[model samples]
Target chain A: MSNKYRDKKTGITRREILKVLGVSALSYGFLGASSKVYSKSTAHIVIVGGGIGGATAAKYLRLLNADVKITIVEPKSQYIFCPGSNEVIPGWITLEDLMVTYTTLKTHYRINVIQDKAQSINFDKKQLKLEGGDTLTYHKLIVSPGPTHHYEGIEGFNKELAEGAFPSAYSAGKQTMNLRNQILSMKKGGTIIISSPEDPYRCPPAPYERASYIATMLKDNNPTAKLLILDSKDDFIFSNNYLVYWEKHFGYGKADSMIEWVSKKKGGNVVKLDASIRAVITSNGDIHKGDVINIIPPEKAASFALQNNLAEGDWCPVDFFDFSSLLHDDVYVVGDSIEGDPMPKTGYIASNQARVVVQAINDELHGREVGSPFIINDCVAMAGQDYGMALAETFRYAGKGKKLGERYHILGAEKNKGKQIVRQQVAENWQRTFRKDVFE
Target chain B: MNKYLLRLFFILSSIGFSNSALADDDLTGGLSLKENFELAKKFPMPSPWLLSAQCSACHGTLGTAFNEIIPPLAGMDKQEFIKKMQEYKTADASNFIVMGIIAQPITDEEIEAMAGFFAKLKPEPLNQEKIPRDVVVPEWAVMNKESE
Candidate 1:
């Protein structure tokens, strides 16, 4: 109500300066020199997908910063782990053993678990729209929606065919169980065909492990059955190690062995599939019939990420330190959806990435200087009932000024008899411990 | 009046002298040029042979521990040890909480030295000859249900 005049040196009113000084003095007295006041009331972090990566991020973020509000939007109420699902086909572990619910995350961790799929994201506005017509506003969003199957490559391979004829069983749910049941119900002397896609896919060693487990089961129950692996690539990451284990345990090199591997370089690439005939046509114009056909198609980022304009080419690109999207500032992608040069898309790698992203969010909220961040991964592949191999790597990020350093392969191995026993026991322990660490 | 002026001068000089000493102390402790160089050299420096003796306290005479919870470092991969040390420095990941704490203060050079020393160590059989043959299984293996 008092008259105010602008200063000659600057356009700001003298009263405005006085008011600002008063507010600054009060703030300084209350919070001290180091503290900061952010524009938002509280940092709201929303994580999509309830897989290992997403769940780990949600749990760690809540633990690190209790003040930050965390909400997890996952379409599924329960998750069946894909890591140990290979054992299901061999009857080593049941489907029920791999099932995990979000009760632990909701009750013990106090993370708001919502049963909704994130339909769309408005990055500019920092808002996410759910399929249920509800809108959620978040200060930061972590999207680890996992990988979606690429169905366009094969002629007669689609969702319906994958379910009924040859199930990919890649996403780890009912399809995985269905595929397991089909394998169990097959004839004793039946021929099983498993197709492996090229590189840049989920779980590089998984297809080989599946073949190994299936061979183990066949040898035990139906010794006359033959399992053939048709690989798109000539040399696989763990082919040599798996081959050694298979030869030692299942007599893989013998003429009447249960398992056989055919590389594309050796003329085994399946060009087209006839689901009704239960046969696949090779690129060299040869048709091979099988009692059961399992085609693991190529993969891309989850459908939600692609549809929401969060992907660059096939995968999402993120800043290695915070895992924030390069395309969108507010959106952060982790797990198999993001393109990490050296890190493989495995469960352990995703969980490690989640921890890094959670720390970055905490640092941003607390106004603390971020440290030099590092991401590490370990991939374990079980080739037979007892034999397995492991690969581990670590990636370090220099600060903002310098480029990130090269990734280092920390550990790698080939399976042996002594190591096999240790690996088998460790695999069971890892499945239980890792699931509890992330979900519980 | 002259005495009071002299006293004020002495007090002022003492204050100036203490301030300069504080500045020097800060330079030595914090991220100054000298400190950075010292850290760089200390971090990647190799450990002496005596350092292996220090590890023998809890890890046994060689690198084998009393139980499986303490993994045998003998024959462990060199690069894996380095990466694991770095992970411990970040205070992330599980399965090695104590190792992480022990490794927190160790430099990269020390890690390399330890890894080299341990890699060369021959795997010694546990001192189970004195114990009864029926009690051969380690306690951890039994608890984990991994006993043969």
Candidate 2:
């Protein structure tokens, strides 16, 4: 009804505009702009997936422009975070602690929370089809379907195998628990085979973190239990710290070390699985038997993204300008769905990508030129509860049609115990705070 | 933009901004810190950092403050914010190599706007009803002393 919203050429008022949008304000997101806060924007933004990236996008979009219509289409009403999910495996944290709901997103941010799976996107019509054949239209679409583990990539593995006996547990839900329970009940002096996949997986250091935590969990309880980390990559993200911590605590590098890492160079790549016997066949044709096998298979963008033509190959190509799909206009590919190399696929990185995309969209609505992006990743990793580590990197846009240029730095080993404790404590705190930041 | 000139300009500009746009700040005035943050989302930001997304990555949003390694700046003293920023700009801040890299492109004008935006949010102290988070407020990070 405000005169400022008048369509001069069509003589249509802003009230008429809403009437044409026709959807219920609550059903389609309708947070009115506070005159003292922000200018009203009529742009409609839709996001798929309600994980860290999508949720953050919805929150930030509202913060930047109160009038922008935002909707999130997620299959599950509750989201389980994969970050602190590692602790769940060791019983250090529960799945409940890692769980969050979309209620706050709907109530506090006034974002439309559609409890349904986004079936397919009608790019031509700018419409997203829900499960029941219902549709929602948008001016911009954000795709943040997290990574999908390629269990099929392994000769003898599949999703069923991942969920049942040979648990991938990478996505961090029921499988994480299955894996945890399996380790807890294993016999004393048992060997647990944790086969890690190639590079470019989510949280590059996580598999190692899991190995460390698993080692700690068994240090006192099942003292002779050993953890075999068979990795596809020759080297991993935090080998320096992991080896040091492993040696100090688990007597790593000794004859009866608690944890033994088999790098790719040493025929450590697990090419096949024998779930019946709880054994893994590496590329070098070595069959290693174990009491429990955690096959964290290689990963690719979620199937939904690939099926809907949002991806080029293993991942979706994005414009550094705003994370918009390079192949599709008005469609943004964020989180693990993106092929952003040098910038690892991490929750921290995904959240940052969401921020950049929303800012770019907001700028476009204001009829301003979208500036080159400066993406930063503060990757904080911890091996044990006592030693924490951090890697800080900056990715800046090089130019049109080029991926982002990069700058990297990481915290070095400290000599003192207090410094190590501080980092470790901070890592724990960061996990809790980051969880609340997105969901709470 | 010289830092001093930028500060002077912001001071001159806020005379009008405070008198007009902020005249009806009733919602934020009597609300709880949590309620204030929910309301602050609607508050318009200044230039360069028009969106909280730019700073919120490392700084954490109002909902989640960074671990004690990086101090929360929202509702922090303006002069204190400015001093820390200046130190980073001049490469005088030790143990903040990341901040130095991030602050390189931030202009004096942008710095003023960042301070103004946080101060206006009126963030309450992080004492009672603290959100579950991993945060450490070490002395080096808390070098945000106000200008007397």
Candidate 3:
């Protein structure tokens, strides 16, 4: 240890650098910013769904506790991220880049990655029944089974339409390819209609971002193509940014504009689809035809969560502070499944909620009181590769029966060109890296 | 214009620069953390390690609580973190071959995120009792606790 400081070139090791730097660097300046805890206890923690939320929960649980036995029950061997997956529309990334497996969680963290569907939970006995006819007992449980689309809710649209001709592409695997192909093969002056769902959807900015990217692609090859967005929501997350991007590239609100958005207030809620005629009927009886129709339907907690009675209405109600399911004991739901209203079901929010749940469990094991939490969502969205905008909302839990003290700090559109491009790159890099952060 | 004079001038300037920087005994890389915090706030990722790609295998999210032998990047002064990483990009940054080799292929943007992430992280005193697993408390952490 004594020779650790001996450097050959300048006789300056990292030890020398640390000593040269003052102690104020760690003088509780950084540490005092937040009260973080670390303690361990032995217990079996079972997490269902190996997507972003469950994977993150398992990782943080292991990071905070060295001895907890964590077993993640997921059906698939790999999880494909949906964060920047809309880039797949414009051929920015492949589906493989979004895919991640459970090898690291199993080998490095000593987490048991069981490849099977979590059929049901025996709440009274604190047990989980797997589809493979095995039962596992747990002291704590996390249910992060992500969204199950209600494709049939829209008349004349079902799983088949999403799979073959009219693609939803919301789930980021097979349908993604279908949508990309349809966009590529779309005829000159052909219209691609993107019917967006209402609020509380995964990545609220996706439909608009999808439209942005589709328009971007159309400009390169099919410039005469028109992309109409029939949105269920009146306004989207980053409306201004999308408008600006469309105006600059596709001539928004113009006679020859390639992009047009019809909000629900303006009869954008699509009711029926005539797949044979390649057209859709909106709520107020207006029929708009398109060459390719991508209908992103309303969502709820996955059938696994709902069938097991994890949801209150369409979403699983949870204690916001700890993300513990309000419906059942020992069950916590994070990610898109949770009734995290005002919190759009984004991947980052899900990951942050996972942290809260982990912290709560760790504190419980250590017999410490979990304090009021401050949840900050740096919700970011980019319009194409050039323009980006964000909403940084800080949510502080005021108390029970009161809403979180929320404040929005937006990275508005007025920022310079360089910052926007950097943000776009950061958003792009974040998707690829977040996949690794969760699974690997 | 001559080759010999140019070589002499380059060596003299390099030597003079190193001596002056070494003479002051001030820890380099002391950029204003406030300014860095403002910039890092603009970034979307929760932490720099997320953006650092493969580095998170050893480096934790905010670059603290690493293995015992290696030092953590957390709470290090922002500018100092940048300087050490800039040095590590060289094949000969240290006699111990690993740091330089691992850091050699890192980009400028990655280095910025690393520096900014660590600087913005909340610091925690290395309590021997807290970290039951193998973790080395650096001399800086030790000195801070003792002084407090």
For every model in order, what is the number of clashing pairs?
0, 6, 5
Candidate 2 ranges beyond 4 A from true positions = A1-41, B1-47, B50-58, B62-70, B85-93, B96-120, B128-148
Q: Candidate 3: where are CA atoms >4 Å away? A: A1-41, B1-60, B63-75, B78-148
- Report the lDDT tens digits of candidate 2 across residue range B39-68: 333323224443334556545674225344
Query: What do the candidate models score in CA lDDT, each in turn?
Result: 0.65, 0.71, 0.67
- Pairs of colliding residues, candidate 2: A429-B134, B67-B135, B67-B136, B68-B135, B68-B136, B68-B137
Candidate 2 vs candidate 3: the TM-score winner is 2
The alpha-carbon RMSD over the true interface for every model, in angstroms, is 21.3, 18.9, 18.8
Candidate 3, pairs of clashing residues: A30-B122, A30-B123, A31-B123, B29-B79, B29-B80
DockQ of candidate 2 is: 0.06
| Candidate 3 docking quality: incorrect, acceptable, medium or high | incorrect
TM-score of chain B of each: 0.51, 0.47, 0.48
Segments of candidate 1 deviating more than 4 angstroms: A1-41, A398-416, B1-148
Q: Specify the poorest-scoring 10-residue window by lDDT in model 2 chain B.
A: B20-29
Where is the poorest 10-residue window by lDDT in model 2 chain A? A31-40
Better of 1 and 2 by TM-score: 2
TM-score of chain A of each: 0.87, 0.91, 0.89
Give the CAPRI rating of model 1.
incorrect
Put down candidate 1 lDDT per residue, A71-104, tens digits, no spaces: 7899987777777877766667666666677776
